[model samples]
Target: MKTTERVEQAFKRIKELLTLVTDWTKQPKEEDALTKEFREKKLQLIEDLYKQLGELNDRFMFTHESEFKTKEYVVQYDALKKKIHDLEK
Candidate 1:
């Protein structure tokens, strides 16, 4: 698959995982070994996506034409992290 397609899939997967993660995210929840490992892998994938897509000016994901959508992605990502923060407090 082309880089464009790969980028597109990455965004989709991230969105899906973010939703799934947020659903289960709770305050001071203890992760089992397998769950911790899975979360680590997901974080790595997100970091890799940021590195691969960070350079593009016009397109973060091909389907996202407007820059605002890209910013929206960041907003959602931040919100997810913030949710975890808020729940912990």
Candidate 2:
């Protein structure tokens, strides 16, 4: 290939790479904490809260409808679990 053609091909590759990365970061999605430690801590806290709430129910035999509703928010932590990400930056 001519020198001009080689340079043009290189520029094309660079442009493609820039486009790929640019589009990827354009939109941000709601995600749990980026760090493993934080996610683990949050997960742990959720488990602890669940266990304590269970113990409280066992001791007091909860009957109120609102008391049952309190556990609904704990489901939010299911998606907040520490996912073992395989992708490298």
Candidate 3:
């Protein structure tokens, strides 16, 4: 698959995971007891996302330098980073 396609897929997955995070946060009080397991799973998902993000960054930096494409991936990477940070907290 093309780099652009790969990046787009990563973005979609990140957005989905973010939605999961939001839903997890909105769970009722009774689910509070499962928060630890829920968080661990989310954190693991973020780690996997980071792997893809890192590959995209490396491709942009080392293979080809296209401002338009790099900007696109960078924006998604930044957004995913922010989500991961929020979940970490």
- TM-scores, each model vs. reference: 0.31, 0.36, 0.46
Q: Would you list the rank order by TM-score, best first?
A: 3, 2, 1
lDDT, candidate 2, residue 51?
A: 67
In model 3, which range of ten residues has the least summed lDDT?
A: 59-68
List candidate 1 stretches off by more than 4 Å: 1-29, 57-89
- Runs of candidate 2 exceeding 4 Å displacement: 28-89
* Model 3 spans with C-alpha error above 4 angstroms: 1-33, 66-68
lDDT of 2 by residue, 5-81 (tens): 99999999999999999988886555555666776776677676666656655544555666555455355333333
lDDT of 3: 0.80
Clashes of each: 0, 0, 0
**RMSD to true structure for each model, in Å:** 24.5, 10.6, 23.3
Error of 1 at 68 (Å): 22
The positional error of residue 76 in candidate 2, measured at the CA in angstroms, is 18
What is the Å distance of residue 77 in model 3 from its true position? 2.2
By TM-score, is 1 or 2 better? 2
